[model samples]
Target: MKGKALFLFWTLLIGFIFSTNGTLVYALESPNTDNYQKDSSYFFIQYNGEEKEVIVNGNITLKLTGWADDSKTTVNGNITSVDSSNSTEDITLKVNEELNELPLNETEIINYRIIVADIFKSEIVTTQELTDSSTIVVQNNNGTSIEEVKTVDEYDTVIENKGLIYYSSGQSGEKLVITKEKYDSLNIVKDTTTIESNAVSEVKATPTTKSIKEVQPLTRFSKSSTPATTTTVANKVPSITYSTHIQKIGWQEAVRDGALSGTEGEAKRLEAIKISLENTPYSGGLTYTTHVQKYGWMSNVPAGSISGTTGEGKRVEAIQIKLTGEMATHYDVYYRVHAQTFGWLGWAKNGESSGTSGLAKRLEAIEIVLVKKGEQAPGSSERRYITPTSVVYTTHVQTYGWLQPVKDGAMSGTSGQAKRLEAIKINLENLPYSGGITYSTHVQSYGWINEVSNGQVSGTSGQAKRLEAIKINLTGDIAKYYDVYYRVHSQTFGWLGWAKNGMKAGTEGLGKRLEAIEIKLVLKGQSVSVSATQAFKEPLKVFLDPGHGGNDPGAVAGGYQEANINLAVANKAKALLVAQGYKVYMSRSDDTYVSLLDRSQKANDLKADLFISIHVNSTGSGTTSANGIESYFYEYNPDYPSKINEDMHNNSDRIKKSVTLTNLIQDNMIQYTGANDRGTDGSAFSVIREAAMPATLIELGFINNTNERQKLVTSSYQQKLAKAISDGVVEYFRIY
Candidate 1:
């Protein structure tokens, strides 16, 4: 598989979404996939007035359209979305001429519900009739009744000689209208008509019955009359009822992230809704993520909305308003729509507000805008609102994500250290703002760059324009040059900044453009790179020193020998590392006595990069309860220079990795062999103090603790103990 010309894909967080040839990437880069912030998503069907109320059942045909983010691919999954703003209505005229049935008034509707049994909740997506909110009919005792319906956009019906017994398949308050001409078999002998109204009717009888019976089909838009009519299916949980109204219309809140919509909590049960909605994602059909930040949840907020009863929907029994200017270092607001008014709402920070009681004296909406990477939109660090506009109007719009498309080419540097500066120039040829991947050289850990199209030599090129930065002290290993990514959009679609390295999958074309820039180098001979990766070729070697020896026991614990344990465990690990081609040497292979000086001599003789020593554990309490494993490195003590040198090894973060590995091993071993995790220790022991390379020593279990001592005496325990130590070594390196 080596020479197959494999493509190196590095698509990262949010921005492109293109799915082609059945190769779809389910996970699109969203702004906050990590923090769970998402872009827009959801498929929608544009409805005509006659098709508003659709009752879903068997034989339903469906086709829909949706949106995707800036990615070229996305994974397939259930679609989650709010109900569409527009709705359609379906009315049917079913009549038995012999029965002489009467028609319904224009403003009125008659309902005949049929409770179908054994309907599976999942099959609704495949069933055709179930997809349409309008078309619905229920089988009744005598004949089929009106099933379901919705108002096309907004409808105001004119009721005639009314006989309205509204029917609903499953939706709440939705209904379909029936006509008298359809049911002409029944006669109106009473002076007053049933469900009478001033609208058109299908019945040929003069208005007589004055009783107006109202039955809003469980799903129709408009006031409904009370009735005990209902349809219950077997073995199915009630389908969650949802509405297109602004208030809490569904069983759950839609957007549950602070930065995206400000509503916070566990990721909404989006997968459930997506399954219900025919695999369409809800948030405006966006495939990529938007951004991320630490967040809280609407875990306490129920999915339903309050009645705008003014004050005290602050749910719970108390109201606490906190207004402090001290916001957490990382805090973002989430958003959602209120069911009562269908308005947006969001989560707030613990300590951020207006005017001070000591803080700003007001509550504010949270809005943020960031231009996506690989895009030409001018990236805004944060959002700024027009102060003059009404504030409460946009409290927490559950409707949209704060996404701004790329506008133009941001600049880079002066083509200093880039491997192929020539490609940078070619990349800018047809770009709206010609700024040939302009970039300067960077020698420091921290750096900056300007927008390429805004390629000014000063402010836009250096540390001042570092659009994004990470905290890794990198010394340029795999990448030879930094290629900035640009986007294609309307007026401002062009260059942005250094291709956030590997931002999207199969980005060879972008890399090819980056390889085209030609730079003028005045080198007298060959190019001299400051990052000299070519300087060293020797393999890193490490000498393992299992502290103490035969004649001299390091630390007397219980009745066990620490020196014997150290050498035995170290030898087992030596075999493992050497098997993987790592050169290793041990201070003393046998139980024969050896001095600390001699151990360092062997390590220094081999020019090792690391030295590790093993030992046994014990406790001063001398109590049976006192037990556990402990790892020791050098202790940082300002009083001694050796202390500082060993502290250097302990503080390098490598030891922490060692400690974690040790703890895991000891914990597992303790569980299996009845030993205990005494935890790890980083201290300055003599072996740690004088090692030439980074070093550490580990203590197995306490022999002083009688229980552990007895356990240590068995060959089975010893072998398990040896395996644990070896495991810790391998984990510490994250290599073997």
Candidate 2:
């Protein structure tokens, strides 16, 4: 137990030492033998691209780099020195920046126990009988006879003789011997053997043999009761070889027959690829194309040529592969890719697209295989390459302010409240291409503001300026594949005609405010059913009556007639409402006297939404001190003893709505004109009481007061009154 423990300890120590110095070793034990003898058997192997010989029991230091595994199947290093003495000296080597594992080919191995450097790894075996050959013998320190095996054909052979000896060595300089029975039991056949180091090449002589048969190199060994059987064929089997150029890493070593060539789980993009056919008897080759980033699908290229961009930092988003000529008839090429967001996608065959197209995703890894015609596929062949596109938007409204964003043809602002959209922001979602959505807005005071892109604000926020018109468009690949359509709900127009791809969407010079907007991103050549002509809503009809016009001159003071001042203010208010996209009607446009009952009848017949009678406050004598603005809405008073119409009596709903309108107009008139606030009250005026809709009477500053009448008669003060009344009407509709 102590001896075993000590052996284990020393073995571990030596392994640690070698590993620290970047050396890998695989050790196999040979059978024990008592007889010690010096043997002249040697191994012939390729060293530094040259064939060399190494004798048994010879010690050498080998310098190698890029060591991969215990088997050393893939190596990019070579032997730098050779020695015959049993000296314990450290060997040094240079390492490659990126070490890769590669498959082996022919011509890598020829005989037993030989280490080949800078070449693929393989082993050869043969089945033959030894006869009529010279035998060489040697004597060890004990003077015992050591029989030497003779060289046969270049291939390894299986002998039928008994009592044959096989020899091997270990680190402690111990010899291992294999008896004939053990050799036969091993059932050694033609198999692959990899040279692990740039060590001394040890070649054992092949015994003389007759009736020798050839076999292919072995890639892996498996246990069997008998030797592996092989049948001769007339043609070589066809195979596919491929390599990938990856991000950060350059082109990797090639792999064959459906082996993986690119990295998985590394987040590296496959930028380019080279694919070719090997060992094929057909006359034609393969062709492929790639969908690249920024530059869509590239042109087709022949096999072994690059089908995508390299060194430009572009990603391969998709690929299509197919065969040509006789090869196409004999086989079908199938492939799948590991995409950026989708992971391993379904297989694609015969030139169908394999990865995503417009999604702007990258290909990370890939696997390819060829099947004979009508053979079962490796996986499902359903193509999956779709990306959804949409537009999102938000609006700052007159009173509601910035509402939450809406998406894809949904309304972003208020609809029927007559609120103006003050500001806007827009963005595109899942737009699987380059560039972004850009938009420009025509504002009330600032026309055609510079364009803003992708969720940026395009209209005024806190300034209370309305977005009168807008233009939307896309850039780069987004423009190439998609069209942006938008329509607006203006104050009077309701919904205007649909505009597309940078066309004007709302009224520009007419000064109409956009109330609501709907935006959509449609694929090119697809039809979306949006209103292409004005889908007019019933406009908010307002009836404005200039009180006591024409035949009856209203209260006159300081040479200013109340009738003329009322007419001027009403006309100005009509013009302002018209610009705001409202439908305004006046009982007297040019001071033609209309009775109070006739005025209310005209407004009711028109089915107006609101009614306001413009007038001036008065005291019969010019000496009165009464001054300021006031408004009145009607409510029924049973004690008044005057017979009232049914629409005017006990109509609580109309009274409440009229009161709201009266207060709004009264407050705005005082605010704009800086007049004394006489506030609002309920009255039984004939025009307001008999009106069917919400009705109010607004009184300008007192006409009998010299100071107030002086200001009211001026054109500037009249214009201010018009603006105040129009704004109050707008505010009323915004709330109710």
Candidate 3:
């Protein structure tokens, strides 16, 4: 039996959906079944199997077998022969009728099996004969009955059932024999457990919880006397938990961390069962389903939820557990079960089953293992939970320095070491977990080298270059589950506060030598007070251009100078922006004229993230009636601009960003000033079109409109405009 080949035959139902005339308008790749060659009309099969289509030949019969010469074949109904050219019924109408009964939005595949006694000239044993030979006994409460059995043989008669049954001690103390007819009709109330027939004996099963063990591989076929074995499963690692429903005993308590959950010595058959995870706060967690004695496998359920029936009294023979979300992204879970006759079944992962389904022998024992799913970058690193602990590190110097031991929150290098450090290493000496760390350093000559992992040397040995700056970050899953804190002692700035993740520990561009460093790892929920860093250390730069100045009055009317109003508003906005942590620049601080090209070029040189051009709109003296706020963003048109350079192309990339900025500024300005909402528009303004980043031009108001001009010149009104624009900039940063 050990060396014998396990030739398993599977019955797969496939339906081909084609358009009219039996021709597929579009083709699709066949399901990874390499044995089949899919085509538009007729598909060739490499293995003998059954397939269904909307219409077959002229007859509405299910296609029984492919051209492949294999023992396994499929048959549907009593059709003895099929001819593709025969007259066929209008299957389109029939298919539509059947579809009408299904929910419009619901999609499902319904399948059932039929056992045939004879094909053309060959006589065969039906599936019921195989089921009868298996001699498995299961109790059913009320009037529910199990479905008919499919093809099965003596060598593979056993199946892992997932449902549970109830039983009492009195029923198990003595062995009784129940005939198939009587057992099927009897209303089992959990009292009866052990029953014997001439062929096999019914045994009760109990589950127990166990602790996680070292990784191992599974042995496919083993005798009952053989000890249980385990090995690696998938690429991602995860924890598993399971609970069992027993006959008469109802549901036992959930057990995890390798502890068994089913009955052990108290001979009682297992019925329904549920499997889940110990912790899944961040992910979709675990999902699993079980194969019942009669019902086969049920629908999938999430962690801690049940799949099989409890009150109906069925034996759980097999099960499959799958991981999802963040948990699945990191690991996979595999499980197997041992039955009374079958000492140990094969291994199953994700959504695969291990035990015999039709065979009624009780599941005696079970094993589950977590395996990693895929390899991540920074190779040897893996994720693990972290607790509060000090990360100790030490650096070896070139000449006279072997520094004192440094722990978490302490600097390791000496700023005065003007001499080069040869090598450095780190360790989580006091932390109680399976994990490591990654660190990188900036050298006098190298300027930032590749990062090293888990107490490894980072700096060069022979080459003498003083370590100027250093950065340390956690490697593996701990990087996301916890925070690593580090600070550096700089040449001039002294000791800086803690920086987490990949934040720089020492100063750059200042030629500051890193004297020492400190490192610590904190659990996610732990509270740790540290220095705060601005979203942008040097606030985001912004360039404000007042549309006109000096000789150019810019749409002056009603004795109000558009240039002065623009300058006043820009100045107020600059003050407010500076106070709000922004580095603001103006094209003109006074009435000195600045060319449009110069304004845009200045903003580009400053590398501003945003630019705003302020101006007053006028429809001339006769059309002074028009007065409203309108914001314009640059629209990139290659033909109209004529000159296209790399910078212009880069500016073109921000067309969408400019639109967003214009809308925000316009909305905020209108809301604040209570001006007419003229809306955001696209324009080809010289200043905005040339400036990089999200630049926009705002026509504040009609200068010729007497009322609007009066309000625009007032200091209070100008401040309102400035504040509104400033708020819009803040909102833009908040979003992007």
lDDT of each: 0.31, 0.67, 0.57
lDDT of candidate 3 over 128-202, digit per residue (tens): 212111112332232222211221222121212222222211243432333444444465333333432111112
TM-score of each: 0.27, 0.32, 0.34
Residues 510-627, candidate 2, lDDT per residue (tens digit)?
A: 6678999999887775666555334323357899999998888888887878899999999999999988778899998886789888988899899888999999989887556998
- RMSD values for the candidates in order, in angstroms, are 27.8, 25.8, 21.0
* lDDT (10s digit) by residue, model 1, range 165-217: 43322244333344544433332223223421211111111123322222222
Question: Candidate 3: minimum summed lDDT over ten consecutive residues — where?
Answer: 95-104
Name the runs in model 2 displaced over 4 angstroms: 1-235, 294-296, 384-724, 727-736
How many clashes in each structure? 176, 8, 66
lDDT of 2: 0.67
Off by over 4 Å in 3: 1-537, 642-653
Model 2, residue 9: C-alpha shift (Å): 54
**C-alpha lDDT of candidate 1 relative to the true structure:** 0.31
